[model samples]
Target chain A: DAGITQSPRHKVTETGTPVTLRCHQTENHRYMYWYRQDPGHGLRLIHYSYGVKDTDKGEVSDGYSVSRSKTEDFLLTLESATSSQTSVYFCATTGESNQPQHFGDGTRLSIL
Target chain B: AQRVTQPEKLLSVFKGAPVELKCNYSYSGSPELFWYVQYSRQRLQLLLRHISRESIKGFTADLNKGETSFHLKKPFAQEEDSAMYYCALGDTPLVFGKGTRLSVIA
Candidate 1:
């Protein structure tokens, strides 16, 4: 519990709709990351932000986008949602490299 | 490319039995391995890191670079120990394994 919070703990939406997930951190960590958890795939990184306004793609960044306009907030957006995008999403943050990451409760999104 | 591999998808052990979750990684650089656990309805939390070499909640994992393995071990499993465990490598953006679901039966 490193003061990480993810908005929309649960969401249900339809395909082709727009969806955005928010991750807010109180620790003011410089690094933030978004990941998706699937049954057979475990956790796959979607995107990450090393600092405000600086972001990078991860292993599974396709069809997903992220922005960190502020130091305390990182947003993950899906321009057009798909059934394949339905999964439990987790947000993590760390102060420095080689440090253990603190994770948020998670957001469970379902796309129909 | 760095990759973590968890061989078992599910494992069952009776309470008080010894438990071991196998994890192997493929990395050429100096590896920073970690074990994370997620209880039902709870967020994933760090259990232990190879660099620290400390045991948390009766769990210990040793990094064997020669074998490219970092397996989590607990001498006596408890019912509460049942949970989903993930082995991860790297620091900036960890590469996690598929995860292993441990079920400790009474």
Candidate 2:
């Protein structure tokens, strides 16, 4: 796949429960990102990592926390899942600062 | 803050006909733009980038910083080109526009 893969392709959770989604990349890229795709919002960045343990928040980072303990792995955790947080999540990686990103198959999460 | 706008929610064209998907962006600094496509049951993949200036699958896009537009164009669209196309602006984390669902009929 030359690429990344997201775990738990589809998940159904209840409100106030905690959940974690994993994004694993085999490309050895330095930059990784998490984004949520919604109907009217397109894809909004939730969190991103520049290097191992170096992370930052994106436009829609309020309820999401991310960790990049290794170069090939980035994990996004929802402290307390909310129904509003349900959406399709995508993971991406880029080799260059001005290059196009490659995305993984999305994970569909539903918070009940 | 950077933003990408895809004006048309849906665009339809017959096979062998010309097709264009409009995309506009807002950024203060030197910008980078890209186009991504998603076919049914497939992962989102990069189609092209403005910096490369390369044409993929007979499609090309010119980055217009003046108008902040990077429109995807193809002279003769094929049925295989039907997919959800998204325009993004950024190098690391992107600002993506609501995608344009393209349908090419034979």
**Model 1, residue B44: C-alpha shift (Å):** 0.4
Instruction: Please estimate how well model 1 matches the true structure, expressed as its whole-model Cα lDDT.
Output: 0.94
Per-candidate TM equals 0.97, 0.92
Q: List the pairs of residues colliding in candidate 2.
A: none
Candidate with top TM-score is: 1
Best by DockQ: 1
Of the candidates shown, which would achieve the greatest lDDT relative to the real structure?
Answer: 1
The lDDT for every candidate, in the order shown, is 0.94, 0.90
Please report, as a residue range, the 10-residue window in candidate 2 chain A with the lowest summed lDDT. Answer: A94-103
| lDDT score for residue A78 of model 2 | 100
Q: Which segments of model 1 are wrong by more than 4 Å?
A: none
| Predicted complexes: DockQ each | 0.76, 0.71
